[model samples]
Target: MALQDQPAYLIKMRAKPGLGDKLFALATEGMEKSGSSDRFIIAREDADPDVLWNMEVFRSHEAKDAYENSPLADELRDEIIELLAEPPMRIEVHPYSALPDGPA
Candidate 1:
């Protein structure tokens, strides 16, 4: 399938003060262990040190749905919520395009 047509989400999280680093670590760990994602990127906001973002692309719609309903995902969500100052915000989309690797 075309990468541009894949299911994706941009998630925004607000970590409790002094917890951004810990949140980033957990997010990175989750990405490394993900089985259904085509790509995953976790980033921190420079201006807002306690804010984090995650861009995730799933391999397919089914993959995304299965992952969302899985026990592992539930566990991860519960863990992540503990560090958040408020509920996460999620924006769902299909990617128009992306570089396979970051810009030169």
Candidate 2:
């Protein structure tokens, strides 16, 4: 998808030590219910195993909005916020193109 054709968001988070697994489980459940098939990337780059990155895509602004307003969204946000060691960093972007079999 071109930049103008897709809506995306990147949410970066850090969890308390030993909390990564729990967080990932909850996030997966939430995403599954969000009606979004967008892929995600999770990683740990520092000594702390808490660092995580979630990249999500929506077909359009309307689709994103609907997902955001859903009950699943509320549950997901609450679940994530409770597990965070700090507030998540969120960025919205428009993708120009997707890598082969990658984010689009």
Candidate 3:
């Protein structure tokens, strides 16, 4: 599949008070090692310090699915759940266009 055909997601999370930084660090590390994403950006909500957001672009739907179902993901999820204030929200999106370099 082409890079423009990649799968992407917007994930919103609310970390327990005082645990936002930890959550962000853990999630960032996971993404860096996941091998499923070509690029991912993680951010914190300015209005709500405990709120976190992640935009991930994966090579393919299959790659994303495989990573999500893998034991590594499970381990990370288990760790993440303990620091979350609530369940995360995930929105799937399609990439319609990108710069010459590609989607960031």
Candidate 4:
């Protein structure tokens, strides 16, 4: 089924030294629990060693809310918080449409 009204969220994090691997592992676990592996992306920017970017897409705001309210999500948030040097930066974007000729 295609998502009718999905929203994209961009999350930027500043991590402590050597915490990237742990963060990625925790994110994977959280995504699995939320049934959102298809919408999760984690990337390390070459320009900054302490910076990581996380992008998540959901079918709607309600889906995002549900994931956030899940027990597994709470546990994952706590674990991620402990590993981060500061709070993550999150931005929401609207996906207007998709291209017809390319892979989504």
lDDT of 4 by residue, 1-104 (tens): 35436777788987778897788778767776787433667788888766778877776677778877888888888899988988899998755565445676
Please list the residue runs of candidate 3 whose C-alpha ends up more than 4 Å from where it truly belongs after superposition. 100-104
* Residue clash pairs of candidate 2: none
Write down the RMSD of all candidates, one decimal each. 1.9, 2.9, 2.5, 3.0
Regions more than 4 Å wrong, model 2: 1-3, 102-104
- For model 3, how does the per-residue alpha-carbon lDDT over 1-104 read when each residue is reduced to its tens digit? 87668999999999999999999999999999899998888998999988989989998999999998999999999999999999999999866766666677
Tens-digit lDDT string for candidate 1 (1-103): 9997789999999999999999999888887776889988888889998899999999999999999998888988999999999999999988998767867
Q: Rank the candidate models, highest lDDT first.
A: 3, 1, 2, 4
Judging by TM-score against the true structure, name the best candidate.
Answer: 1
TM-score (C-alpha, index-matched) for candidate 1 = 0.91
Per-structure clash totals for the candidates: 0, 0, 0, 0
lDDT at residue 76 of model 3 (Cα atoms): 96
Model 1 Cα RMSD, Å?
A: 1.9
Pairs that collide in candidate 3 are: none
Candidate 2 lDDT tens digits, 58-86? 86788889888888888788988989999
